[model samples]
Target chain A: MGHLSAPNDIEDLLRTLSPQVLGALVRRFDDFDICEDAVQEALLAAATQWPREGVPANPRGWLTVVASRRRTEMWRSESARRRREEAAFASAPADIELGAVLDDSLELLLLCCHPSLTPVSQVALTLRAVGGLTTAEIARALLVPEATVAQRISRAKQRIKASGARFRLPPEAERSECLAAVLHVLYLVFNEGSTASSGATLHRVDLIAEAIRLMRQLHDRLPEDGEVSGLLALMLLTDARRPARVSDDGALVPLAEQDRGLWDAQTIAEGAALITHTLATAPVGPYQLQAALAAVHDEAPRAEDTDWQQILGLYELVRTIAPGPMVTLNRIVAVAMVRGPDAGLRELATAERDPALTGNHRVDAVRAHLLEMSGDLPAARDHYRLAAQRTLSIPEQRYLAARATRLAPDDHA
Target chain B: MKYLILIYSNPQSREIWNSFSRDQRAAGLRDYAALHESMVASGELIVSEALADPSLAKRVTSHEGQALVTDGPYAEVKEYLAGFFLLECPSMERAIEQAARIPEAAFGLVEVRAIMALDGWDI
Candidate 1:
């Protein structure tokens, strides 16, 4: 807390400590719902007071004390109003060791991403509990109503309570599975920010930053876990190109067309170094392979200089380990880049049989690109139009429609 | 999931209702009351209400800055929405089961439709 020079730095410090303080409280109080609310109140207090009064000697300990007091006060008033003696006893534990709170960030993350909750609920609760975002902030980041975010978070916590899950890690048999759920939630949060599915704005940077921050914390706690490191690296590598991902006029610039000069060289280097270290040291997971793929993209000085051979090999490994429709589509792009457009089109025909790919705009967009490369201008234009019509993202629609328009006159000629 | 369970009224159903004995009509009302009570007890029902006469409905259209009014319950349509139950169910199957419990389902006039969220799909 000594280097808390700027207000932004203080905000970051608060966010980083929010989960640790909440984890400590919930572990001791054994009441996640009340503990979460108390922690939010504590965070709000810190946000307002930290900059004015100067940073505390131990920010995390200070937050835990404040939140614990709030929790006791809340329960005490409730118990008195209801005349429930047990509530008072439960609220004020005699052995409260304020200074000896252990970091329970991993356990908190597992609880937030509980499998009983729906993906939407998991995303909302994870943002609030682990990422340290408020309901209004989460709603703004997700382009959802505040009520919806609040409902999801509350319902998720209730479900966790109903599941009878404790504030600790799962059993050895279930630990890896639970950790996978946590990683998936973080991946979803990052994806939501990387691509605004149905919004006017292309990127919700707040969510992206939150995802990376949470992933970094996870990595710090479980440094030996390859997938955690891989995910952190992947997020960094993907986010590094964000500066050049959009045009001045707010249109999305596809990867091949983006000006590489605008990419964050420092972030790329960091991500590259991390992934390179991970792939060498740990057993390769899907995320690590994806990070490797992203690293290849980031290392290329120009779009034309991209090593499609290496990328294609990596996509193959990613597909083998974790097959997904998007991975299939990306692999086809690499196929076209390496072999030929006709070869890619042949692969696309087989991939079109996948139920998940049916009616997906990205498939159409990919097909259009391949057809354009194969000198099938009319077909490419039609596919572009289809893609433009199918996509919900405004920027993607604009870009696809522009591609179709660019080829319209050529059709007549 | 939230669903709108719509009960449709047609000329045939209305004729059958009109022809029912007093005892039968009262029994029908009892069935609806029972269903409403069960839904409320289960925390499934958000709101439910019967409609006014469809003939009283009016259609409004703007034409060159002028508002034009026309009689609704279009003559060509055979079925009109009579009442609806707004229910929060766990799944489509549950909503359908609730819709089947409605008295109008005997006439094949009850329908269950999922309510769309703001994003069209969940995150």
Candidate 2:
């Protein structure tokens, strides 16, 4: 534990150990709500003590013991008869073996993302129980009130308890579906972190890092699962481009215009290698295909070298497997690149008929890009302005408006 | 302390808003979004919302114990409350700073009113 020298290192270590400690407590006590609260107290105690007294010889064992003791004390504060039975049962000397406790993390994740809980609760609980973030940290990350986060987490634990979910993996029949839900939760967290929808905060970075760290832990446990590898690869590749995603003025820089030199090369290499390996070994999934797309964009030395033909083919696969409005819109952009803008516009006209695509700003943004490519400057400017007004994101609005202004005549201004 | 920042707009300003170009409208929305983002990040924002048009408002009155309802604009005031931000700030200056950041404050009045707690008033 001497490796935990810096304060930042200590924080990271605790975040990593938090789920394991909570998992062990719940497994022993069979009470998710009480166990979670006890583990949080233990964590707070450790957060304050470790730096002063030095890291304990066995951090996980130490936390498990402390949390178990707290659980007993909490039960003791109840009715005397209930306390006698609960306290005695809780204090029964169960070995807090480190190796066995490590396995509880995955089960904790599963229970946090149980089907009974809503998506919001799942996210809140997952960050609290698995990601080791405090309620305040989760509240700030999600931009909700601390009370709201607290309520969601408590509600989620109660739901899981009522569902009678065990402290182990779901049955074989439900394993894949449960895993998919877990993946979706992680995906949602990653996307929320990467985008920074409001466009002015550092809290998003913490979420991004936490999502990736949790994904890495999952990947480590299930090394043989390709989709897990694919999801992790996708996050790393997308996050790698973050450095070049925005300009100094806080405006979003489109992929084509971003400086390739500013991209994080090490992350790109790691992501590309992971995807390249997974794509070869595993059945194709949506996440793997998306990661493959990101790899394609990252591998090209310049925007001109972007293999659009291959991208179009991959989009075809994605649409065939899991079609959505955004997937269709992105496919149209690739269509414009490979074919001509007019060809893309024809497809866009039909795609816009879907009610899902109506009034979506990205559609207008795509239309503007195609119009510009087709030499219709006035029309492009109009669509850009319309798209700018339709978006709520400040950076996207500014970028679209700037594009519109750039195309306007000097006298028109 | 908690402060209520009221955003007011008059007919003249509404006309000006109607006359604005698409880019101007987008710019206004962007400024509002940025201000909201900053407030959220700074933990000053409790809640904020834009109200529907005043024309949609309904006025309710109790006349001789019977409830009566009618369309709004009971008085021909120069301005109306278009939106508001309920924020928790450390000081009046901080509240004022946030109020000034509201895009409407550039031309129209953005008032900052203190929210009185039960303990603040004497019997």
Return the DockQ of model 1.
0.09
Please give, for residues A61-91, the per-residue lDDT of candidate 1 as tens digits: 7888888889887767656765555655655
Where model 2 places Cα greater than 4 Å from the true spot, the runs are: A1-4, A78-80, A83-87, A90-94, A197-199, A203-205, A409-413, B1-123
Give the clash count for each candidate: 0, 0
For each candidate, what's the DockQ?
0.09, 0.03
Which lDDT tens digits does candidate 2 get at residues A323-346? 999899999999999999999999
lDDT of 2 by residue, B1-123 (tens): 578999988877888899999999999888889988777655567789998877788899999999899889734666889899988665678899889888778775699987632111000
List runs of model 1 lying over 4 Å from the truth. Answer: A1-10, A46-58, A76-95, A98-102, A196-205, A410-413, B1-123
Q: What number of backbone clashes does candidate 1 have, counting pairs of residues 3 or more apart or in separate chains? A: 0
Query: Which lDDT values do the candidates have, in the order given?
Result: 0.84, 0.83
